[model samples]
Target chain A: MKYKSQKVAYWFFAFSMLLLILQIIYGFIMAFAHLGYDNLHPVIAFNTARAVHTNLLVVWLLSGFMGAAYYIIPEEAEYELVNVKLAYIQLITLALVGVTAVIGYHFNYWEGRKFLEIPRPLDWLVVANVLTFLGIILTTLFKGKKRTTTSLVLTMGLVFAALLYLPGMIWFDNQTMDSFFRWWVVHLWVEGVWELIMGGILAFLLIKITGVDREVIEKWLYVIVGLTFISGILGTGHHYYYIGVGKVWLIVGGIFSALEPLAFLAMALFAIAMYRKGEKKHPNKIALSWTLGTAIVSFVGAGLLGLAHTLPQVNMYTHGTLVTAMHGHLAFWGAYGMIVLAFISYSLPNLTGRKLYDSNRGVLAFWLSNIGMLGMTVAFGVAGVAQVYLERRVGLEFGDVQKEIQVHFLILIICATMFTTGIGLFIAEFIRYGQPTDEALIAATDHDA
Target chain B: MLSKSQAKVFFLGGTMVTFVIFLGLSWNSLSKEVPKRTHEENLTAQVVAGKHIWEKNNCMGCHTILGEGAYYAPELTKVYERRGEAYIKVALMTKTPWQPRGRQMVAYGMSDKDASDVVAFLKWIGEIDLNGFPPKPDLKK
Candidate 1:
C-alpha cells in the first residue's frame, strides 16, 4: 500500500467476506431444499433463499470490485483518494442497504426480477450509492498525475455499469418488455462491462506479479475489452431468443453469442502469454495461482460451458432447466468471484505489511475451493442434462423429474461443503493478516515488481 | 501487428458501432415487433393487476415465466392454457399451502378478484409469440 486511503479497501474486502459466507449459507439452504429437506419452508422458503443467495453474490462482488477500484486507482493515477471519509460512509450505506434488502426477502418485500430482486425504492438508493462511488473514483483519477489506460478502462466500466442499472428499474406491465430491459442490466453487466473491470484488474495484477511492462499489458487490455464489447453487446440476443422478441435475434444472438467465448479464450491466453514472457517472477505464488486460475477457469466455465448450450437449438431444451444452473455456477465463480478473491490475495500481504506469501494453507485454499467448485459444477451439469432429457425431452412431469434428480443435490451439498471449507481457510488467513496500517505503506510504488 | 493506438481505436470504435446497433435493434423490437407479437392491445387493467400480484408475491423467484427465473417449479408461461383458469384459481385462492406432489408453495390465499387477475395475466402471457420456445419433446415415446 503506497497511499493512506488505500487502507479503506481492506474494510470493503472484509465486508465482502462476510456477505460471501452468508451467500454460501443461503446456497446450502436451497441445495438442501432440493434434496427434500425443505424444513425451512414456512420460515425461509426456496424462493426467498434463492433470492438471498443470488443477490448476496452480486453485492459481495460489487463490494469487492469497489475495493479493487479504491486500491488500484490511487496507485495507477498517482494520487490519493479525494475523500476517504465519504468512501467509508459509502461503505456503511452499502452494507445497510444490502442487509435491509436481504432481511426484506424473508418477508417477500422484493421486485421478483431474479438478480434485480432489490425493491424499486431501494433501487434508487443503490443508484445514489453507486453515483457517490463513481464520483470519488473519477475525482481521484482526474486530479492525479496521469490518466493511464488501465485506470480509464476500469473507470469506464464502473460508469457504464451504473448507467446500465437504470434500464432494469423501469416498470413494465408486459413481462416481455420487463424481461427485455432487465437483460440490459443483468446480461450486459456479467458478459459486458464486468469483463472490462475484470480485464483492467487482470492487467494490473499481471504487471505487478509477473513484472510485465505496463505498456505491453495495457495494450492487450484494449484488445481484450474490444473483443468483449464486439461479442458481448450483440450477445444479449441469447436471452432474447426465447423471450417474446423477433426472429432476427435468433440469427444475431446465435452468431454473436457463439463468439462470446472468444473473449474468454483471449483473456486466458493473454494471461498465460504475459506470465511466460515476464523475466521477473514475484514471490507471491498464491496470488499468481489465483490470477492464472481465474483466467483459465473462466474460459472453461464461461466460454466452453456456455458454448455447450448457447445455440438456439440446444437452448430450446435447456432454457429454464437446471442446465442453466450448471453454466451459471461456474461462470459467476470463475469470472467474477475468483477475480475478487485473487485481488484480495494479491493485495492482502501489501496492505497488512505481512509477507505471509509462503503459507501452505493459502495454496490449499486456492485448490480446494476451485476443485470443489468444479465438482459441484459437474454435479449440476449431470443433473441438468438428466433434467433436460427427462423433463424436456421425455415429457416427464417437472416434479417427477426433480424427484429423480434429488440424488445429485446430495452430491452438490457434499461438494459445496468442501468449497465452504476452503473459503473458511481463506477467511482464516484473511483474519490472521491482521489489519492495514500506515507502517505497511512503502515509500516507492514502483518497487512492486 | 496491432499497436497501442490501433488497439485503443478498436476498443472505442467497436464499442460505439455495436452499441448503436444494439440500441437500434432494441428500439425496433420494442416499437414494432413487441406490440404485434405480444398483442399489446389485450393488456387490460386486470392483466396488469395480475402482473402486480405476481411481482408482489415474487412468484418468479420460484416458478419461471418465459424460461426466466428460478427453475424450482414448473414453467408457468403456458399455465393458463395447461391448467385452465379454475385450476389456477384454486392454487391461488387456497387457504393452505399448495404443495404439488409434496413440494410446497406459499399459500397467498388471494381474493377471488386477485386470482382472476392473475389468471388474466397468465392468459395474456400464454398468447405472446416466443418464436417456438419450450420446444416439444421429439424423442418422447
Candidate 2:
C-alpha cells in the first residue's frame, strides 16, 4: 500500500468475492439438478444456472486479475495509478454489465454461447470498461520510474486478453465458424494469455514472499511464458478437433496439447525451486500455502488431468461427457480460482495494515477448500468415466447413464458443501480485516514485503 | 546458463512464430476446409434461423451440439438423423418442460417454424466432417 491509489484494489477483490458466493450457489443448483432434483427447473433452470455459474466465474476472475494489477503495478513501476477515479468508474461499470448479463440470462436475453454468453450490446460496454481499466494501468506503468519485466508481462497479458475478445464478437452465420473463433476468446484466454497473467502474478508473489532476486525469477518467467505460447497458442486445436474442423487438427491438437502440460510442470517446479532457493521466508504462512498450492495443483489439474484425455484417441470416447467437466472444474479452480485467492491472501495485510496472517481459520480454510475441490474433482472423474463407458462405450442411452451416475452428484454436493464452507471461512476472514486506510502505507525501505 | 535477455527473446520469438502459424492454419481452415466439409451450400436460411434459436435459448447450456455444450442432455449434433424431426419438434414445441427419462429441459414452447429451424441447424451440424468424432461405440454388443 505504498500508494493511495492502491486502495481501489480492495474494493475489486471484495466485489469478486461477493460474486464468488453467488457463483457457488448456482453450481449447487446444477449439481442437484444432475442428481435428478430439478425442483428449481422452472425458475433457475439448468441452462440459466449453468450460464450464471460460468459467467460469474469469468467476471469474478477478471475482477480479481484487475485487482492484482492495481496492487502490483504501482509498487513495481514506482507510481500511483494515473486516474484513480476512472479506475473506480471502470469497476462500477464492470459490475453493472456483469449484473445485467446474469439477470438477463434468467429472462432468456442472451447470446447463449458457452462462455461468451453476454449479449452483443453489453459486450460493447465490457469492451469500453476494459479499455478504461487498461488505459489507467498502461498510463501508470509508462509514467512511472521503472518498467520491470513483471509489470510488462502482466500488462501484456491484459492487453492481449482485450484484443482476443474481438474474435468471439464477430458475426458468423456458420455455427462451425462461430465456434471456431469463440475458442479464440475462451480457450486462448484461459490456456494462452491467462497463463501469462498467472505467471506474472506468480513471479511477483515469489519475489515478495521469498525475497528472491527479481532478475533470477523474471528470467524463468520468460521461459515459462515462452513454453506457454509455444504450446498453448496452437493448443486451441484441441477444442477444434471435433468442431467440424479438418483432420489436420486431430494430429496438431493431440501433439501440442500434450505439450501444454510441460508449461504447467515448469511452473510448478519453478515455484518450488524458487521457494527452496530463497533464504528469507515471509511470515504470511497462509499466503505461502496458497501460492505454493496454486502452482502444484494447477500442474495436477490442468497438466496431468488435461493430458489424460487430450489425446485424440481418448477424447473420441470422452468428448462431450462429464470428463470435460472433470478437467474443467480443477483446471479453473487450480489455475485461476486459487491464484486469485492466493493474491488476495498475500495483499490483504498490506492493504488493511492488519497482520492477521497465520490464524487457524486461514489454514483450515485453505485445506478444507482444497480437499473439498479435490473430492469434487474425483466425484466428477468417476461419474464422467462411467458416463463414457456406459453411454459411449456400451451404447446406453444418455438418460439411463445419467441415472446410473446420479449418486455421484450426491458426492459432488457434499464435497461442494465443504468447498463452500472453506470459501465462506476465507470470506469471513476477509471481512474481519475491514477496509484499507492511508495510514497503512509504509516507507518503501521499511515495509516487510 | 540462459541470460535474462535471451529468455526474453525466447518468449518473444516463440510467441511470434506460433501465433503466425496459428493464424495461417485458421485462415486455411475457414477459407478452404470448413466450407467443403460443412457443405456451405446446405446452410439454408432456415438453418441459420435455427442457429439463432439455438443461441437465443442457450441450448448449449444443457444439450451439446457438435459436442461443445453442457452434458446435461444428449449431444444433439446428430439428433436429426438419430431421432427424426417430429420428435425434436415435440420436445421443442411442447408447452411444458420436456422431461426425457428424468432430466428436465426448458420448454421453449417454440413455434413450428422455430422448431424446424433448430432441426435444420442440427442437420447442418450433423453433416460436418468431424474427422471421426462422436466415434462409434467400440464395445457395444
Candidate 3:
C-alpha cells in the first residue's frame, strides 16, 4: 500500500489475479463433482460453485481494471492519483466484499444469473466502491498540465463500465421483462462496455510501451470505441434470441454481435501498425506482446464464438449446450480477463522496483499460461461439439450423455489441470519476480517519500 | 487506359472467386426452414397445450429438445417412440416413481391432464420426419 514513486495500482492488479487463481481451482473441482448419481449434489453443488466462480471473476476483473486504471491513468495524465490511500481502502473493501459474497453464495443466497450472482446488498456496496474508485481516477485526470491522449479514452471506458450497472437493477414482474433487463447488465457489459475498457487499456499499453505517436494512438482508440459501441449495443440482441423475446430481436442481436469481432480484428491491426511504426525500442517487450496478444486472442475466442451462437439458426443447434459453456469459458478468460492479467504482469515488477520478471523463467511462465488456456479452449470446444451430437442430434439420456463423453470429460479435466498448473506457474513466477532487491530496500529506507 | 481497365477485370475475377468461397462456407451454416413435418390436427391442440405447460414451468431451462436449451434431462422429441403416449403420461404423473437410474426422466410434479397434454405434444413431435438427423435423446432404460 505504501510504495514510493510507483503508482500503488499494481497491488490491486495482483490481488485480482489471486482471485482468478481461486476461480480456476473451483472450476476444476466443479467439473469432477458432476460425476454424481441420483438426485444428489454436494453442498458446494454445481449451482453454488458456479455462483462463486463467476462472481469472483467479475470482482477480480474489476480489481484488475481499477489497478490498471490507477497505474496508467496517473502516468497518462502525467500526475499521481489524487488520494492513493482512498484507493487502497477501496481495494481492501473490495476484497472483504468478495469474501462476504462467496460465503453467502454457499448458503444459497444468490441471484440465478450465470455471472451476475452477487446478492442485492453486495451489489450496492460494489456499485459504491466502483463510484469511489472512478471518482479518484477522474479527479487525478482533472487538472493535469501535459496529459497524454490515452487518458481520455481510459476515463471514458471506466465511467461507462460503472454507469452501465444501472439497467441491471431494474427487473420487472414477468420473466420476459426480467430477462431483457438482466441482459442489459450481462450482455452489454461483456460486449458493450467491457470492450471499451479493453480498447482503452490496450491502446494505452501500446502507446506507452511502443512509444507510438499520441495522435495515431488516439485515433485508434476512437475507432475502437466507436466500433465497440455500435457493434456491441446491437450485439445484446444475441442473448435475446431464445429468452421468449419477439422475432425481430433475433435479427438485430445476430447481426450486431456477429459484427462485433471486426472491431477486435481492427484493434489487432492497429496494434501491429503501432509496433511497426514505433520510434524507441520499448524497455518492457513482454508487456507489449501481452497487451497485443490479449486483444487478438479475445477476438478469436470470444468474438468468433459469439458470432457462431448469435445466428438464430446456429444457436438453434448450440444453445445452452456445452458449446455455450465452451464459448463462455474461453471468452471470459481470454478477452477482458487476459487484458487484466496483462496489466498485473506489467505493473507488479515495475511497482516492486525488482528487475526479476525479465528472465527466462518468467517468459516460460507466460507461455505456459497462454498455451494451457489455449488447450483448455480447444478441449472444451471439441467436447462441447461431441456433446451437441450425442444429446441433441442423437437420442441419448442426459446422464447417459455424460457417460458417452467420459473420454471428453477426462480430456477437459486434463485441460483444467493443465490450466490450473499454468496458473500455479504464473503465481510462482510473479512471487519470484516481485521480491524486492537489497538495493531497492536500502533505497526505500533512505528515500521514504 | 487499356492496361488499368484490364487490371480492373482481373481484380473483379479474383473478387468473384473469393466471394464464391465465402458463400460456399456460409451456405452450409445459414438458416433454412425446418423440412415440413407431418402435422396431425388431432394432436396440434394437445401439443400446443403441452407447450403451455413447458413455458409455464420453465422446463426448457432444465431440458432440451432438438439441440436447444439446458441439458439436465433427456430430450422429449422421441419420447412417444420410446414409451407409448399412455406410458409417458403415466410416468409423468406417477405418484410412486422409480429412482432415475442412468438416463431417466424424472416424474414431473404434474397432474393427470398435464401429463396427457405433454404426451400429446411429444406424440406430435415424434410423428415428424427427422430427415437425416439422429434420434432424440431418450430416457434410456
Candidate 4:
C-alpha cells in the first residue's frame, strides 16, 4: 500500500473473492444434489459441478497467492512492482482462462485429470500467465534495496509451482504414468511448495502484527521450511499407495506423510510462541485473530487430520472414500483458505486506510466460517467412516452406501450455510472499505510512522 | 537457539537433501517400478486413441481409474473385467440418463467408436499389475 503499484493487488483480491463466491455456489449445487434434489443434474450435473467447485477453489487460492505476492514483495523488497501494467494484464488473462475452463467443464470439454483438468491448450496459456507473474515478482525483488528470506521463500514457491505444472502437461499413453506425473503437480503443490508460500505470508504477518523483530520471525520461517521439505517431499508417496506404483511406496508414503504433521505442528508452535513473546499491542486485533487462527487451525486441519489416514493401514480403507473428502475439506480450509483470509485481513486496512478492523461483522465472519467448516468436516468424517464400514467392510453396493449417507448431506448443507454466511460478511466488509486511493497511501505511511 | 546464518545454511542443506531424495525416488519409479508393470508392447494405437477419448470426455471426474478420482460413481479400474466390454458399451450408448436412486451418471452421448475406445483404455489399465491395492478384507474374521 505504500507504493502506487501495489494497488493492482486490490483488483486481484477482488477477482479472488468473485471466484470464491462462485465456488461456494457450486458447493451448494453438489450438496443439494447429494440430498436427492438433482434438479440441476440435467444442467450442471454432479461431475461438472464438482469440477467447477474444485477448479474454482484452486483458481481463487492461486489468485489470492498472486495478490499476496504483489502486496508483500514490494514492501519486503523495498521497491515498486517492475511493471504494474503487466500484472494487470496477467490478472485479466488468468480470469479469462479460468472462466473459459469452467465453462468448458459444463460442456465436457476438458481433460479428465483431476485438478489439472484444464485442457492442454489452456495449460499453455496458464504457463504463460504464471511466467509473467513470476517475472514481475522476481524483477522487483532483485532490483529492490533488500531481498529478505520472506520474499525469497514466497518467490521460490511460486517458481517451483510453475515448474511442477510441466510434468502434468506431458502426454503419457499409460494411465499409471499419467497418474504418477499428475501427483508431481497436485501432491507436490499442496504438501510441498505451497507450505513455503504459507510460511512466507505467515512470517510477514507475524512480524507486522506482533511487533517482533525480523530476525526472530525469519528464523522460525527456516524451521518451518526445513520441516516442510523433510517430510512433504516424500509425502508424495502417500498418494501412490493405491495407484499402480511400486509396493515400496506403501512404506515410504506412510512413514513420510505421517511425519508431515511435524511441520504444521512447528508452525502452530512458532506462531503461538511469537505471540506470547511479543507485545500484543497491534491495534488490528481481528487480523491478529486470523493470523493465530490460521496457525493453530492448520495444525489441526492439515496436520492432525492428514495424519489420521496417512498410515498405510488406515489409508487402505479410506483411500477415496468420504474420508479423503473429509481430510481435503479441512486441510485446504485450514491451511490455504484461512491463510488467505488472514493476509486479506492484515492488508485490507492498510491498502484502503480503513480502520474497519474492529467490526462485529469481521469477528463474526472469522468464528462462523471456521466453526461452520469444522462442522462440515465432522459431518464428512462420520459419513466417510460409515461408508468405509458399509461399502468396503460389509460389501454393500456403492449406490446403497450413498443412500445410507444421504442424511449427512443435510448436516453438510446446514454447516455450509453458516460457512457461506461468514464468507458473505467478510466480503461485505471488504466492499464497505471501498477502493484503494492516493490519500489512503499517504495515510498508510503516516500510520506506519 | 541457532543464529540466523546458521539456520539459513541448515535449511538450505535440508532442502537439497529432500529434493535429491525425491528426484532419486521418482527416477527409480520411472526406471525400475513402472517398467515392471508397464507392457509398452500392449499399448496399441487403438488404446492410445481410447486414452485420448477418455481424457477428452473427463471420465476421471466421476469414475475413478485406479482409485484416483471422485467416488460418487463406481471405480472404473476393473469395470471392463467386472462388466465386460459389451456391457460398458451398452451403458455408455444408452441415451436414457441412468439416474440411480443415489448418485446419477450423465450419459455423455458418446459415439460407438468413442465408447469402444474408452473400454479399450479401461481394459489396458486393468492389465497392469497394481500390487494388490484396494485390499479385500475378510469379513468373517
Task: Give the number of the best model, judged by DockQ.
Answer: 2
lDDT of 1 by residue, A158-207 (tens): 99999999999999988899999999999999999999999999998999
Give me the overall lDDT of model 2: 0.93
Winner of 2 and 4 under lDDT: 2
After the best TM-score superposition of candidate 1, give how far the Cα of residue A241 lies from its true spot, in angstroms: 0.7
**TM of chain B, each:** 0.97, 0.97, 0.59, 0.89
Q: Which stretches of candidate 1 lie over 4 Å from their true place?
A: A443-449
TM-scores (chain A) of the candidates: 0.99, 0.99, 0.92, 0.99
Model 2 preserves the real interface contacts to a fraction of 0.87
Q: lDDT per residue, candidate 4, A7-71, as tens digits?
A: 88888899999999999999999888877888888889778888999999999999999999999
Per-residue lDDT of A1-449 in model 3, one digit per residue for the tens? 22342355767867876898888866775566444332334355455566667777888888888878887776666666788789889889889888998887766566554456576688899899989998898888886555654676667768877877876765333333445567667876887677767877887777666777667777666666666666776666676565444455567667777788887787778878888898776656567657777877787778787676677777765666777777887788778777986776666555666655466665675677777777777776776787777766674655666776656656677767776766677677677666434344234321112
Candidate no. 1 TM-score: 0.99
Better of 2 and 3 by lDDT: 2
DockQ of each: 0.86, 0.89, 0.09, 0.67
Cα deviation of A310, candidate 2, in Å: 0.6
The 0-to-1 C-alpha lDDT of every candidate, in the order given, reads 0.93, 0.93, 0.65, 0.87
Better of 1 and 4 by lDDT: 1
**Cα lDDT for residue A254, candidate 1:** 94
Best-to-worst DockQ order? 2, 1, 4, 3
Residue A424 Cα positional deviation in candidate 1, in Å, after optimal superposition: 0.7
lDDT per residue (tens digit) for residues A95-177 in model 2? 99999999999999998899999999999999999999999999999899999999999999999999999999998999999
